[model samples]
Target: MSTDNITKEKFVLTITADSIKSTDPRFDINNLGLGDNYKALDAKFQNASGTIITRDYKKGEHRNTNQTMAKLAFQLFETQIINLPVEVKEKFPVYKENVDSELRYGIYSSVEDFNRYRKTREYMQYHYGDGKVFVIYSWNVFSTILFVQECLKRFGEQGDKFILTYREKDIKESEAETLESNVQKELDKPISEYRNPYSRKLIESKNIIFRGAPGTGKTYLARQIAADIVSDGYYDTYESLSEEQKQQIEFVQFHPSYDYSDFVEGLRPRINDGVMLFDLQDGIFKKFIAKARANYENSLKNPEVIEKETLVQEEIISFLNEVEFGVDQFKTIKGSIFYISSVDDKYIYITIPENNIVNKLSISIDEIKQMLESGQEFKQIKDITRFFGKLFATQEYFYNFPIFKAIRGSRKKNIKPTISTEKLKKYIFIIDEINRGEISKIFGELFFAIDPSYRGRLGEVTTQYSSMNSKVEKFYIPENVYIIGTMNDIDRSVDSFDFAMRRRFRFIEIKADSTTAMLDELSEDNKDSNVLDNDALKDEAMKRMDNLNKAIIGVDGLNENYQIGASYFLKLKTLTFNQLWEDYLRPLLQEYIQGLYNEDEIMTTFANAYGYNETAEGEADEAFESEG
Candidate 1:
C-alpha cells in the first residue's frame, strides 16, 4: 500500500503482521527486501502513478526502506493535518512550529515521542481534538505493542483533569471581601435609636414652623432629618433624572433687604467691551429651576422610568402666543412664570395680563417680553412697592394705600406661585440659621408654597387685595421639594419666631444631660487610674456641675449667664489635682460671683463644691516640697 496521496477520510493505519522471523544478525533485509518485497515495490509504483491509498507496512519492509518511508511519511503528514484555529495558534506558536517540524521528521513511535513534539499547542490540541496517534514497527514487536496499549489507556479519560493539572494556574485570595463586609456591617447600624417627634411631624405635614425658646435642638433635628433623607436612598430615585429637573431643593436666608431679586433673579454687573453692563443673574429660585432643567434633561437619557419636567421654553413661548387680544383674555392663561411682590402687603401675581378696563390701560407686549428676558424688571416692581409700603405689613396706611397697584393686583388674583411639592420630594435644602433669618422676608410668595393645601397638585387659586392700577395672578407650589433649617437657640437679638412662621416647622429640643450614652463612652479613661469610678460617678459630676451653674447665676446680678456644659467637664478632667484648684475651680468661683467676691470667697466656693482646697493661693508649692 502506498502512503503518498492518501485521501481516505477518517482513515487509521495499524501494523497487523511482520515477515522477518530471523534472530541471525547477518540476515540483512534492508538489502534484500529493497528489491523483493512485492507490497513495497507496488507502493512505490502506486505513488509514481499518483494513486491515493492507506498503507500498512510490515516490520521487514519498514527496516529495509526506513529512510525512504520516513521521507514520504513526513511529506504526507504536512499535507494531511489542518492548521490550528487562530485562538489556539496564538497561544502556542512554538508548539505549532515544533509539531510542524516533527511531522517533517516522522520520528514519533510512542505517546512520549509525540509529546517530545514540543510546545503547549501539541499537548492542548492532542487532548482537545483527536486521541493520540501511535507509530509502531509491527504487531509482534514488544515496544510497539506497549506504546499502543498506553495510548489506548489515556484516550477515554476526562480531559478536564489533564487541563487542570497541566494547562491552568490558580489565583490568590484577596482581602477586599473581608474589608467590604466590615464596612457594610458598620453602615447597617442606626445613628440613634430614639424616634424624633418633631422629625416625624415634619415628614407628615407639608409645612411646619419651628418655634421655641433658645437651646432647643430644632436646627439639629432638621440636620438629622436631612442626614436620614440622604442616607436612606430617598435621593437615589432622583439620580435617574437630568441634572435640571432634579433641582427640587433650595435654601436662602432672608433679611430686611432680601427682596425679590435675591429670591428669584436680577440683572447684575458684568463687563462688555470694557464697559460695566447689567447682566441677568438667576436668584436662588431661578438657579434651582435651571438645575431642575438640567436634571430633567439628564433623566430623559436614563433607561429607567422617572419623573421629569416636560415644560420647555418652546411650550412657554407657544402659550404666550396663543392668548387672545382682549381685556378679559389674560384671565384664563397659565404657565410656569409668576411675579412675587414683597411689600408690607405681600401678594403673588401671575404673568398674564389683567382683564379689568382700569388694569389693561397701557400694558405692552414689549413690556411682557422684557419681564420674561430680564428678572431684574421683576425686582424693580418689588422695590417700588417696598419703598412705598415701609417694609412692614402691619402699617394701616400702607395696607390701605391705593397706589400699591402690583401688591393689590397679586391679592386680586388669589394665585401664589411656589416650588412644586413633586419637585421638593427629590432633593434637600439646608438652611444654616433658621431662627436668625426673617422668615416673612425670605418666604415671600412662598408662604403658600410651603403649605400642603396650596401645593402644585391643587392648581392655581386667586385672591384680591386692592384695586388701584391692575389685578395680578400667581400659581401654587409643587409637592416634590423639602426644606431643612438649622438654628442656634442661643442667639438673643431676634424676638421669638412669629406665630404664622411657627406653624410651618416642627421643633425639637436638645439639652445638656448626664444620661447620654455618648458621654459615658467618652468618659472612660484608658490611662493609669480612671478619673471616673463608673458611669454613676460621671452622672454625679455632671449634676454637680449643673448645680454650680445655678449657684453662679443666683449669686451674680447679671442676666447674662453661663452653663457648665459637656465641653467644660472635658476640660476639668484634663487638669491635675492642684492645677484643677488654680485653673478651673478658682476661676469658676470668680466667674460665679461676677468678680464681686475676693480670693477668700472663691476658695470657699471651691471647698464647698469639691470638699477640698489648696491651703493658700501659692501654698501648693510648699505642700509639694513637704511631700518630697
Candidate 2:
C-alpha cells in the first residue's frame, strides 16, 4: 500500500456515529480509505465505529475530490436542513495555527455572490470548485475543515452544553437514528437501571419522602430521580443536564429556621430610593409551582389560541414600552382623553388630565389579552356588548377600547415564536432534610395543595398572603409537579413533621445495605484498572458493609437507622479498611453509643465484625504504659 498522501482530517477528530454502524458489512474508519495523497491508506482515522471522509486535495483533482460530500452539503443548504449564518469577517475568529499563516473561510450565499468577491477567487478555485461553496459555508476545502475544528473547540468549552443550532421544523425523519437520540440513550442507560423505579414512584405518588440512615445517598438519589424524570430518561445525573433541562427541577435544603416566608409567599422587606418598604413576594416554592402550572396549562391550550395569546401579550408589552408615562394621551371610545400614568405587572393606570375627578383608571391587562384572544375589534362600543363574560359598563368600555386598539395595532411580530405543544413535562422539586424545618410552618397552605389525590384545582388553597394579590385566584399545584423529600430517620427534627403532611407522602426506607450498588462505582476509574483488583475491592467492600450492618442491628438501642451506609464504605477509594473505621465510621458509631451502658462492649463487637484489630491497639497502649 502507498503511504505518501496518508494524513488525518483537520475538523473531524472522532465520529462515534451510530448511523454509520448500519452500513452493510460495517467497516471501521481504520480499515481502508484514500488520504490527501490520493493513494490507498489504512488507519487514517482512529475511531472504531465511523469512517473519516478524508479531505483529499490534489492540484489536478480539484473537481473529482470530495465532489459527493460537497454536493450533499449544497443539498442540505437548499432544503433548509441547516441554515447558514450570513458571513461576517469578525465572527470567524482565527483558529489555532494549522499551517503558519492565519486563514478564515470565505463564505458567500451563492456562486454569483462568490464571483463578486475578487480577493479569495484564486484560493477557492484551487482547493474547492472554482466558484462553489462547500461545508461550513466556505469555498476552500481546508477552510471548511478549519471552520468545524475552530467552532467545535469553542462549543466544547461550554462544559455541559453540547450545542447544535437548528430549527425544529427544518429536520426531516431519516432512516438512521439522530446523534441526539443516540447520545441521550447513552447518557440515560446507567441511571435508569437504579433510579427509574424511584422516578416512577415519585411521578405516581406526586409526593414522596426517602427515609434512610445517614450517608445512604438519599439526597444524591433524589437528584438522579429528578434528572431522570425531567429529561424523559435521556439524562441520568443532575450534573449531566443542560441548563434549559435543569430549569424543570428545583433543589432546596431545609433547616431549622426555614419557614413559609422562604418556602411560600411572604412579606419581604426591601429598600427603595430612600425608605424601607415591605413587599409581598412569592417564595421559591410558590415561584417554581407557578412556573410548573403555567407549563402544564399552556401544554393543554390549543396551539392557535396560545400563539394568538402570545402575540397579543408581546404586542401589549411593546406598546407599553413605547408609551411615555404621564405624557402620551389617547382617546377612548367616548372621546375621553387619558394620559398614561403608570404601569405595574397586572394593571396599566391612566389619568384624564382634563377631568374634574382626581382618581386614575386601572385598565386590566388581562381584559385586553382576553379581548384579543376571544373578543372582536368592533369600530363602535355598542357592538361590544360583553367581553370574556364581563358585562362592561359604558364607562368601562370608554376606559379600555382605545388602549386595546393601540396595543392591537402595534403588533410587530419580530420573533420566530415558539408555542407550547400538548406534550406535558414533569417538574421535580427536591427538598433535602425536609423534616429539619417545622413542616407545618414552611408548607402552610401548601399542605392541602400537594396531596396526590387532590393535585390540580381540587387541592386549591388561599395562601397566607393571598389578600395582597391583585387577583386572588385559588392557588393550586399542577398535576405535573412532583415533590421528592429526603429525611434522615434518626434526625431529632423528624418529629416536627405532622401526621397530615406524613399521610400525603409515600415514604421509602433506604437502608445501609440497600445502597450497595453505588459501591460498584468506586472500582471504576480508581488507582488500578485491572479487573481482578477492581473485583477484589468491590467484593471486600460489600462483605465489610454486610458485616458492619449486621453488627449495627445487634446493638440493643440501635437498629437499621444507625447502620453504616455504602457511602462510608466508598472511602475505600482513598482510605484503608481500618482507616475508614477509625476516621468516619468510628466517630459516628461513637456518637450513637455515647451514653449507652454497654458502649465499649457494643463498639468492641462492631470492630470485630468490621475486621478492626482492638488487640493490636491494646498492645500499643500497654507498651506506652510500660514506658511511662
Candidate 3:
C-alpha cells in the first residue's frame, strides 16, 4: 500500500448506541449516521438482514480483513495528531541561521530576533558534543557577516568594538585633563617675576640686612612690605582688601626672655571641670599656620567664596600659632609666616592667606639686603603698595619703649610700653636708638628665628626665658609686622650689637646733608613763614653735623660708635638763641676743645657757631639786629 492511502481500510463491527446523543454541541454521530432511527430499537443495533448477533459467535473475517480493520482504526485516530505545513517543516532546520545572519548584517527588525539567535548559540554549546560543531551550528557565514555589521553600527567610527564601552572612563579622563591644565597654568609664572618686592620672593629671603645711617628709611621699608602682604590678598592689588582685612593684622615683640611658649603656644593655668589645671593655649605661630591651612582647605572646597565664620576662625587660629604653646602638640599645629626683631628678641606671626604662598618662597636675607642697598628704584604702584601693605598688615616684633614720666625734680618714672593690642597694619613701632641695645643679650635664640629659612617652620632653635624658669619655648615672627629702628653711629652705646643681628636687617643711611633739599622745601613753605626760612642756614647746619660725625669717626676705638646721625641737626630748630649756647655750643667747647682754646677765644668761638651772643635778650631785638 502507498503511504498516502495507508489509513483508508475499515472493519465492520456492531455496537449498541444507548441513545443518539452527542457530548459536543456542534456535531453528533447520530445526526450523521443514525438518521430517522425509531424508538423501538433505541439501545440496539441490527445487521443489514435484521438478525441478532450474539457475543459467542465463532465466525470471523479473513487475515487481510484483520489488517484492514487495524488500518481503519489508525485512520480513525489520525484527526487527533499534530502536523506542520510542508513549507514550514522544510525551512525549520535553517530558520535560526538565516535570522542570525540578517541580524549580524545590521538588518535586525527587532531585539527579539537578536536575543533568539544568542539563545540558540548558547543552546548549541551544551548540546553539541564537539566545540567546533557548536560554533559552526551557532554561526553561519552569513550570520558572521551580519554580526560584524551590527558591531560597526553599535560602535561609532572611532569606537573599538572588542572592548566594552564605559562613559565613566571618558568622564574621568576629561576631569584629569582639566586638573592638569589648571595646575600647569598656576605654575607657568615664576614667583620671582612678580613685580611686588614685598611678595614671597622678596620677604622670604634669608640674608636680608637693612642698613643705613639713622633715619634713612630702611626699617620703614621693611614695615611697609609687611603691611602690604598681610593687609591685602596675595593675588589682589593693595586697593582690593576691605577695611576688615587690613584690621586683622597683629604684632608682637621678641626679647631675650621671649621663648617658644610665647610664640608657638603653651600651657597656662586654667579651670577645667572645676579644677585648676594647665590649659594649653595655641601660640601666635601655631594659630597662623592653622589659619593658613584652613584657608587653603576652604579655598579648595568653596573656591573664591569666603564666609565670615571662616575668616574669624582663620584670625583666631593664626594668632594662636604665632606664639609658642604646648597645646600645639595635641593639635599638631605648625607655624605661620612671621618676622622677628634682633632687639628685645621680639617676634610677630601674622595670620593671613598670603602667608601660605609666602612660606613656599626660597629667598635669602642677604639678597633682600643687597636689593635695598643697590637702591634700584621700584616704579610700579602695585609693587610699592603690596610691599607696604603686607608689612603693616602682618605681624611684627619690637623692643620695649621706655616712657620716662617726671615724678618730681631730679627723679623720673620709667615704665615699659605695653604690648599694643591695636591692629598691626595701622601701627608702627619706632625704635629711636635700636643699635644701643645689646643684640645677643636681648634677642637670645630669636637670632635664628628672624632669619628667613627658619621663620615659618618647626624644629628650629627654641628660646628659654628667666620668667618661665628657663623653660624653652618656640618663637615665630608674623609676616605683617614691620620693625623700624634708628641708630646713632656716633653714639658709643651701639658697639655691643652682634654681627648676626646686624645681618638680619636691611639698612639705609641718612646723611646729615641728604635732607638739605627737604629741609629747604620745609623752610620755603609760606604756610609757616616765620619758622626759619633759610635754606642756606639748614645746609650749614647739616654740614656741621656731618663734620661732627666725621670727627667722632676719626677717633680710635670708635668705628661702630662714631657715626653721627642727622637727628642732632634737628635740635637747631628747637633751640632759642640763649638756649643754644647754654645747652649745646658752650658745653661742646668746654668738654672736647677746652685745652685748645683761650678763655676769651672760647666765648668768641661759641658766638660764631651759635649765631647769637648770650647777652642778646629779647626776640624783637634779636630779629631787628639780624635784619640790620
Best by TM-score: 2
- Cα lDDT over the full model 1: 0.37
lDDT of each: 0.37, 0.64, 0.36
Tens digit of per-residue lDDT, candidate 2, span 121-184: 2222222345444322322122233333343343322221111111111123221123223332
lDDT of 3 at 360: 19
The better-scoring model by lDDT among 1 and 3 is: 1
- The best-first sequence of candidates by TM-score reads 2, 3, 1
- lDDT for residue 416 in candidate 1, whole number 0-100: 30
Looking at model 3, residue 103 earns an lDDT score of: 18
Name the lDDT value of residue 592 in candidate 3: 40
In the range 1-628, model 1's lDDT, one tens digit per residue, is 3333221212212221222222222223233221111111111112223454333442222322212332233224323322434333223211112222321122233434444543111121121124433232221111122222222232222221100000111121113222233332332223232144344444446444443322233444454454444344322223343445334445565555565566654567966337576644547764564454434334323222121112222323344344332321221112212222211112212222332422212232222332332323333333434533434322222212222223223322232333232211234565656666666655555665555544442434332221221333343443334556554444552456556766565554444442133335335751323343445445655655556555544544532223334444443355433565466656755554554646467446645564345466435433433433
Better of 2 and 3 by lDDT: 2
Q: Please report how far candidate 1 places residue 48 from its true position, in Å.
A: 99
Per-residue lDDT, model 1, residue 427, is 42
33, model 2: CA deviation in Å?
64
